[model samples]
Target: MKKITTPLKEKDIRALKAGEEVLLKGVIYTARDQAHKRLCDLIKKRRQLPFALKNQIIYYCGPTPAPPGKIIGSCGPTTSSRMDKFTIPLLKNGLKGMIGKGKRSAEIISAIKKYKAIYFLAPAGAGAYLSKFVKKKELISWPELGTEAIFRLEVEDFPLIVGIDIKGRSIYDKR
Candidate 1:
């Protein structure tokens, strides 16, 4: 297993291979369907995003509300393929990595190669267990969207696997 820290550099991303286990530390952003749609809309209008995308990692999750005395609630990766339409644009804007579950579309795989980015997979149905990795969480935008709100999270040793590497190698490939 490789231990990595984010915001991941190009070298860090390139060194990773599909199916390799990784333990990631540092800040990652959380965004789900609604947040992705809004981000894409902003990009279409050529407007500023709430935060910069350069060398950043986005985790596709909408965590449940935290209970009292907890830093965050159940947090796990959501289906990544659902955000396929918006992903390429984010990649073009310098987003370097993503953490989510499931296979990606051909277009997204192409974009991953084009942008020299990587896709990571967190275990499915392990939300409660994964929440322990989140050290801190702060709402960044779209509070009205509730669970779908964008958040800035500080995570430590968050477990994942390289589902797709920058070379377009994918763990989910049938071959």
Candidate 2:
């Protein structure tokens, strides 16, 4: 697996290709549908975002409450399409990567290319297993959204596959 670090540089993002396996290490942020909507609203209003987007990766997950003695609980990718409406704006704001599962829309794919971004897919139904990678977690914004609240996470060797590359190539494409 190709090992990569978070807060990816543009050159690092450009090096990725669809279908490549990667082990991501470093800090990543979490946000699901509700959080995404809030972020988009902030952008539309020309208000500052809670976090900077440049060179960042947003993981589409709403982790369950941690069990006793654990850093986090059952963290896994959510269906990415649900957040498509907010994606282009985020990309334009300098977001470099996204982590989620399943196919994305044509508009999203186009935006990814236009913005020179990449999309990654974590294993589906492997939340319990995936949580093991999260070394630390902190609520970052939108506490009212509960599990859907945005969070800052520190992860080590979080496995994923490049679902879509900056070139607009997608793993979901039938061979």
Can you give the TM-score per candidate against the true fold?
A: 0.98, 0.98
lDDT of 2 at 126: 99
Model 2: residues >4 Å from true position, as ranges?
Answer: none
**How much does candidate 2 score in TM-score?**
0.98
- For 1-175, candidate 2 gives per-residue lDDT tens digits of 7899988887887888999999999999999999999999999999999999999999999999999999999999999999998899999999999999999999999999999999999999899999999999999998999999999999999999999998999998975
Write model 1 residue lDDT over 1-175, tens digit each, in one string: 7899988899998999999999999999999899999999999999999889999999999898999999999998999999998898899999999999999999899899999999999999899999999999999888999999989999999999999998999997857
lDDT agreement with native, every candidate: 0.94, 0.94
| Alpha-carbon deviation at 174 in model 2, angstroms | 1.7
- Candidate 2, backbone clash total: 0
Indicate the residue-level lDDT of 105 in model 1: 96
